[model samples]
Target: MASESTTEDHSAVKKPNGFPPLLSKKFGITDIKQDAVKWNKEWEAAIASLTAADVLKEISQKLDDSFFTPQHMELFHKSLRSLQTNVAEILSNLLNNGHFDTIWLLLNAAEQRKHILEGLKRASEDPSTIWGPDCRALCPEVTVSNFLSQSGKGFIDFLTRVAEIFGSPITPAFLPNSWWEQASNLPNPWWGQASDVSPQRQISQSTKLVFEVATITRNQFIGEWQFVLSSAFSIVSDITNRGEGMKEVLHFMENTKGHVARCLAEVKTTFRDKPIIRCENCTKTPDDIGQNVRFMVCSVCKTKLKFEVHYCSQSCQKEHWSVHKKACGKKKVTRGLSGTKGDFLWAFSDSDPVANLMRNLPKKEGRLTLRDIGVNPCNGKRSPAAERQAKMLEADKDVDYFLFTASGEPVRFVIDDLGAKMIFRINRGMIMTQPTDTTGVNAIGEYMLKLMSNYPGLSRDIIIKQLCEEYGEDIAEKIVELEQMAYSSDLLTVRCSVA
Candidate 1:
């Protein structure tokens, strides 16, 4: 026990309530330096056994056995109203040096004194302690209204915030030079808040995101100069089964070219791990940015790909469908008798897949080039000089087009929506003799009938009235009166008309 200085007095003074300073040394708020802590612990056990016959004088004597000075007594008496308040002040001063060991005990004393102050105010509410245990986890940001701007200013500001709340002398070891000036300017690539971060905490939270990216890049770039690398188009092949895939994975381990040097051309390669790509089809254009596409050329085919297809994340690029589907059937030869476009044929040797489509098809009598089937726009009866002069004129004029086989059989051709010609063979004799086998008038009539059946609103005779209105009464009657046209007579007339 600390020995007391008494003036010829065997009588004891009353001890400080609940916390006699010497007995409470182990749990006191003042952060004794380690040497001071060792001495205090040795003395505390000795003081705890004393009877509380005199509360204040004995405890004060025990504290005086150590370096309890007159200055400390004067400060304690002048600043605090009670012993609890005095202990609270001592704890606050220790915390300024950044020690937290006695924080829990100090918190209790502060709360008790705060209650006394509240009682005097007579509202009878329990006042709050700044270090109340319940608050530590729930609060996220501490606002220091005035932030000092200097080198390590952020860290100093943080330290000050802690001192103001707890008590001062927050230990030097507890605060680190915060890297906020450097790191704060960097983007929170994941969009975390900057205010929630603290300079006193152990273990940086950023290792998982940053380290994983670095690992991926290192694994990818290992064999830089080993093989002759060929262009590989991963984008299209990744997106679908119908597209071609990567060329052979070049054995860069066989480094034919200086691939290391080549790859290093990208300054400071960044590897993002487990990055997520929003589905391209689901992403909306930025409301403010307006819509314009970023184009990336495919590595293999040089086909222009949109930023959407290029993939925002590596995982999306990799997890796409693995195999390609065939564009055409694998038959060795064509089925049709024409050397026409769209006719099936043998794959050309050394032919560009994009061109020379039906060039090598087996020649047969009825097979013909489009040029052969197309009208020369000059009569068989005309000479070369007349044909040359009329070429441009014929191109400009509307001519009746005949669809025919190489053998001169007339075939039916309809231009589809996509502008490709679809050929159909029909009985020319039936087409010629029938009053309306494929006449513009019959097509119009069929369309009207379908519309009426679907809609069911309009009155009957709508189609007939429309035809009468459009072509006049004479053509309408001619179309209606014919039960059938005489085939033989019409055929002869048609031949004459053709000749």
Candidate 2:
């Protein structure tokens, strides 16, 4: 169905490598430059037909291949350039219509290109390590691969262009505010706000994109951890030899080290087994069940007593009734369905119920604004007191202060003192303030501040006990409510125990 030149050109291209016969020739074996024109045209057309995912897969496979030689290296570089061009054109077209799926695919393709570049660097440094006899003669030294790897300006430029496209603001013309509001109402608002050009919305979208990119990069780093570490070591070695730009390289090394640590921590946290909920009668959990038999439910306790309990066996329930009878008539401290063991255990775990409450408490920094603390900075529409506070914050922006956390070194902040009112500027536009003592609440505020300052490692149990002893049980409960609010509002710091 095709012409002889077309058929020859199609057949000449190899799987994964995409190298044609013209570019795969050994050193000194020159061919006419014009001969590749037909093959290039055919290759470009074939690439255009393939989806971005397919193109990336091919490139990934090629980068993973172990038979790369100097000849293949040149061809691979040329093929990568061609693929980059094709991807760029596709991305430009997709951008016009805001096709996020295709944009993600193009981003993935760009990621694969970076991987190929890294592979080329590795191949150039140690040719015999990855490739066997096929590449030994052709790549005895770093020549073509080295040049190709170093000429990464083009790839960087392409990535910059892609970022520029993604970073552009989404106006009402692209997506209406009403559409965004409707989309937000969906069960999974994965698209987020598509229209609102507010700083917060833009930041949220940008953060999501960054997180996605970080996830992909983290996966790639894990797959090639050994290679990446070795390369890092090599860079360190280079720095030691030259001693030039050592500080910058050391900083980069520290960031990489931190990144690897975070990745390992994430893996451990994600895959760790859920805590088991044990039975009240035999202290046995679902894990103890030999097969998957359901535990017996206490029907009498449920219908008459309005309380529920579980039993691994009928005999165990009968034996424990003498002790359970006293509490049977009374309301069950832990209430749940008659048979569900986990639900009961969840309500009354050995760990302080308050300790479990810590998980619900916000661990992130709180948002702050002039309006948030009852001050209007714009148009001077504020009381004299509010205006004074705002002016103090504006003046103190340049002053530096130190604050400490459990996890890391003390962070620097800038203090804005408005007499009784004060603000501490921290990272991510977050602000911290001391709790104010309202007329009747002065004692509780003083107690909380003292506890936070004196006992940074104070347990929930200890706090509750102290509060109950000094104040009443009702006051203790109120303290917990206030503490939760304070911690979430960034008014108080809670020391989180490291796992």
Candidate 3:
């Protein structure tokens, strides 16, 4: 506590309620050097007659004679241990596990605080603290109000808001440097008003006893608050600084990324579990079906033709056969270059023989090389034709594989290192069907379906619609027609086996 003279000097300075007075103009706000000098002189005078032995004896007597019983000390220790356990559990669940909701609350605390204040105000008829526009920036109202409201969530919200404002753990500096001196001068009516009776006159009465009890309670609260805050600050500082070269920060960021990835995976799984397209007969989307009703596509089209024509049930497909028969065997429509310029499509799928061949390339106890896939290495700087081949071969070093078009133009199949995305670009000339190898041509058409599977975020039908803009839908329909014949053969074999 500041001396009575120093406190009286500062009491004269006045400022608006909930606002601080200017440090220089304020009467009680003395320089740190002046405070240090005065404190040193007072301290020396007080301790001049007290030797080290006398000080130790006084302290020992106070400790032994104190009213705090052994039971009270045990309870105090138990309370501290309980606090530690609770704090550890909270950190493990929220911080260590990287809870999304908790991270969101921390990042959006400033914006969230507005709604929190509004909700708290709405919950109570009249808030105890003054939440004037100027005072709203302070957190004591939020902290006090939340605790009084008896809501665990409200307290967490208040703590998050406080953390955001402080940018660190709470410390002694949370209060102004001269808080003790300014306490008596507070604008609050209860604090500012002086008692009329003298302490000497009231000493014999119940008023004295009440005053002593209030003083003891205040001192005990201050001691507990200081201990908790200091212990927390120390622990946080140690853990944060334990790692070298900002490793802890990096580790925390990695954990956050992992948490976000898990959240995304869960969302993706939810979507993948549902049907990708609507029912062909009723034109009803997945949402239209009952929860227990499974969405299905035409098995004849899917298994044999690798085409998907969706439906909610077999009955709908059967009823719509008359209309669907006209285009039942048609391939899914595809568009050309719908994405950003130079954004090549990933020309790969489980059905594509080339993709399967590339994926299964031999890795005989080590990294697979070009020789393992039967491709000869380019030796560069031969004839003009050889040199041209050499450049393409050099490019192949970075890519997964290449497939040549009917016009002999090479399409590069590159895999992204970071994102693991497969992409392909046709260097020149359009892919067309040839009499010798129509299989290769059909593979390109299959890539359109692959694009839909690869980028699930985009609608499958929408991708087909866009693909139709570049490559006519007839190419797909032709493949579907061929697939129908193949499916008929498979059906005949199955029936023969049954017979």
Candidate 4:
């Protein structure tokens, strides 16, 4: 990619179009703006003529065909992804601006199908007629989809259908599809169908439900074979189990519809509201001890949900639906009497298994960070690290934050949830004290970082709230001072007054 002469370009290297098509006019309407005007214009143009998005929707079925070699297939993927982006931006604006008239939405889907079908027909009949470096040879041996960007689940969901639309042989996904879930027929530390997975007899009905979903689409190989949908959740729901526990498990299943749906082919007819998920496998620790979670793979979809569980089976995963088939892997796994592992516990390893796992896994997106990896924690004695942590917590406590008068010695405080942030504003005699001198092995810092980084969508507001609730309103108030709560109500005047 040195700015060599025009003669060296891929288009030049291959006689695409038998001659390159002129560059698109700067006005061809391509930009990442999610504006409705752009979307309407683009769609209008598409309705008037054909576009990549439209074509992808139609020929989407033949995604895996010779329509692309690895390189070409990849380019197609990139182009298609861009198209999806365009549609999404357009759609979001429309939704927000109240532009969707049920008919338009319906037409949009149809239009997409038509475009993809047309692309396929053209590729099948006369690939050379299609212009660009992509459509040059009968098959380029390398195509774009192999070389460009792909969406997570959104991309795979679209790509899967594209392959379906074009009659391409669907293969087990070797790669993860969504940020949280890896798409695959293969079960990892989470999903699988055990030989003993019958209804009443099964140990984990929850896991069994999802196993069916993944395996239902699982194609079996038998020379030239007919694919038969298999039942992973053939187990009987225990009829006798109509207690509150069952109700909770059902509720868990209902809220996680999309999650459960991806892994389960058929959600049972919840006789009532789907009970909440009861995670028999979750280890309950006191909130004061720390409710921190780590990256974990789903027992159902193998998606990276922050929480981990000990239950490896559907029934157990469901029974433990209060939690999930995830665990803080800092602890070693041991088998339970029911042939399942106890709750996934947290362990700390200086070796850093998470960083290691990320290093080796296939990279779909070059930009994603630890946000996409599922890693087990390191294991070791908690006391040294814990004590060091406690000491540091103690040191933050020493900063005398409440100084009413310049002459008064600042009232030093143990940094609790409330006064931490506000104390920073008060610069009087503030010193950084070491509760514990161990920096490299600061388990608490590592612990907090792990929680924030790995558990996506965990909001700061929630963290603040949780801290406040755990430490008490006084600590919360001190950490984050409120003008009204501290002054106006006269209620807190009792604590803030210094005699």
Per-model TM-score on C-alpha atoms = 0.13, 0.21, 0.20, 0.17
Candidate 3 lDDT (Cα, whole model)? Answer: 0.33
Q: Please write out the lDDT profile of model 2 over residues 41-116, one tens digit for every residue.
A: 3333443354433322222221212222234334433443343344334334333322111111212223323343
Candidate 1 C-alpha lDDT tens digits along 1-499: 2223321222433221221233334334233333333433333343333322222222223122122233433333332223223223433343232212111111222232232222212210111211111111111121111111121122233434433432333221111213211222322232233345344422233333222221211111110110000000111121122222211111110111112211221111111111222222222222222354332212322232221232223343344313201211222221222221123322212233211323443345635333221222222333332233234323532222222233434322222211011010111112222323334333233323322323333322544554444334443454443313222243233223322
**Backbone clash pairs in model 1 (N, Cα, C under 3 Å; residues 3+ apart or in different chains), count:** 29
The TM-score, computed over Cα atoms with residue i paired to residue i, of candidate 4 is 0.17
Where's the lowest-lDDT run of ten residues in candidate 2?
490-499
lDDT per residue (tens digit) for residues 209-270 in model 4: 22222222111110001100000001001102323323432332222212221112111111
Clashing pairs in 2: none
lDDT of 4: 0.26
What C-alpha lDDT values do all the predictions have? Answer: 0.25, 0.32, 0.33, 0.26
Clashes (N, CA, C under 3 Å) per candidate:
29, 0, 6, 92
**How accurate locally is residue 136 in candidate 2, as Cα lDDT from 0 to 100?**
16
Between candidates 1 and 3, name the one with more favorable lDDT: 3
lDDT of 2 at 265: 24
* Candidate 2 TM-score over all chains jointly: 0.21
Q: In model 2, how large is the Cα lDDT of residue 478?
A: 52
Worst 10 residues of 3 by lDDT: 334-343
Task: Say what the RMSD of model 2 is.
Answer: 26.3
